[model samples]
Target: MASYSIGDVADKCGINPVTLRAWQRRYGLLKPLRSEGGHRQFDEADIQRIEEIQRWIKSGISVSKVKAILDTNQGAVDKGWITQQEELITILRCVRPDDLRFKIVEYSQQFDAATLIDHVYIPVRQRLGFEQNTVRNICGLLDGALIEYVANQLILSRKRKGKPALLISWDDPDRTRLWLEAWRLSTQGWHIDLLAEPVELPRPEFFPGHHIFVWAGKLITSRQKEQLEYWHEQGYSIFHHNPDLTS
Candidate 1:
């Protein structure tokens, strides 16, 4: 669903612009679509092929041969791992903090944050309906384990990456969402300043230093939404999970 320019492709593929152009002209290595201005335009598929070409080149394959391999359209496939949602729910219901943190760390490292949330955490939370008597206890224990292990891991990851940005959660900020955002940013190599609890808008002077500000929460008041828009209108490079604002 994304289109990329030659420069974007060059940066992401780690190929110089000159070399990428040469690959197109010399070996017909790319078949990008044309823009309205007749400039070369690439899609996500092109990016994937470019990554594959890079891998082959690193493995002692020649550039000339790279095109042919791509033409054949052979590539490695991703086999996604399955999660044990019910088992996790059972453990959380039993309030096993030690065992819970172990599973959280293992899965967080093995899979990305989004996958862990969607496949593991979200499913378990949904299944732990109001009818379940242990739901309250499970919720409390789960939150504690996540904050101690998983959230801290994301914090460390962001610290190591060092391209600082801010994450400010609004009223009653969802820690799970914060963890997911922090981990997502960490994976993309950003130094994150996560305000895990609800906080007022950071002072304007602080804005200059951050790459961007992400306002995250499940619910937002009109006042909160307006404040976010005010920051956005001020050219603060702000992003929010609120659908209405983005849309």
Candidate 2:
């Protein structure tokens, strides 16, 4: 049910914009819907095709061979592509963590916290790949239930001098992971702040001292490692988890 621009599709699929257009023009890999202004508009179908192409590329399959495969299996490819896209979008929209948690608590006789996480939270995150859309959904759910849970807890902690909640995020090529974490932490009662872009180890003064800084995927740059160390030194607790490591 979601329609995305070519840029949105490229960001989701982790492909360069120019390369995406090139594939369209030369390889006929994707035929996107055109806007009134002649802009390339893509939907779930185009996103799937790009993902398949990315898989082939990662596996060392030649672009030409990949194209031939798509050509020969056009019907099947289209069906599978659109199906996967629709499922992802659906899972992304539903299976929210906050709602699942409340349902668990409200129906404790029927469901438990662990059951909720396993059945609802975990699967949606896994499919959505932790992006901004997923994050927004998770946050909206948390804003109602989890935030209240944390506020109640905070009232009990009124006497303790707690550190300010810190939010640290690195600019990722694909922001799904970042978005998921932001919403997940917010659900846990942490204040949510974002760095719109990646930063150095010693972040700017605007970043709170007591916040939880999250890092994602492969730490491919020295700056990333430095940022991690800097936050650790600043007394902010780090919660680091790699999906690939667990999965």
Candidate 3:
């Protein structure tokens, strides 16, 4: 039997450590044993439970729904006859191995390259597991066509905007991704400039009144974390998506 610490499980599961801790504290999905020094140590079963929770969330189930199902040990919840567990399974089973790639190719045919990249390919990647290295690799292999198309769409979409929002992303992010994410924000009328890292962000200026910043990276360090706290204090709506699922 293997017992892993919180960091170990987070790395293996492709989830953020903060998110893992929140799941335990907030959702009761994991109950790890604490070491003498108070560090949490979890077993394989705990890891699996986190994965299941991730899967449920991906299917649009709220954390409350997941907690209720876990608490009751029910096969599935009523949810008006459409169970979260069932819906997640269906989506997982239906996603063919190369569905994303195929969809990208198909989208290229119907829409101009940029439109395909923004509306089609980007959304497909968003649905994928962020921590899965394969998600980036596969998307990378298809990058040339997708990037070109998406960049064009973003340029075109910029004409009709409010000011932009600032963005900071992980270095070497799935290249096609961070840009598209910025584009998504921009389309919602936000002007954006992706920073080197959240910590590198300059103090907010008011030329175009850029007031928000988003961090879309693999990890956040302590210093960047302080910056995030500061941003929150300044009344920004910051969001981090957890991409891990347990079953």
lDDT of each: 0.65, 0.54, 0.56
Candidate 1 lDDT over 1-247, as tens digits, reads 7899999988887789898888889988888998999988999988877776776565345788777655443321123222366567778767788888788877776777656654566435544532356685477677667667655766577546467677666544456656555656665666676777766555545667466555544345677678768987887766665322332
**Compared with the true structure, what per-residue lDDT tens digits does model 3 show for residues 91-162?**
334544354344544544654533433334543444344436554345443454445545665577667757
lDDT of 2 by residue, 112-152 (tens): 43333333443344334445564555544433453444344
Judging by lDDT, tell me the better candidate of 1 and 2: 1
Clashing pairs in 1: none
Candidate 1 regions exceeding 4 Å error are 1-83, 129-132, 158-162, 200-207, 218-226, 241-247
Report the lDDT of model 2 for residue 220: 34
**Candidate 2 global CA lDDT score:** 0.54
Question: Per-candidate TM vs. native?
Answer: 0.54, 0.32, 0.40
Cα lDDT for residue 65, model 2? 63
Q: How many backbone clashes can be found in candidate 3?
A: 13
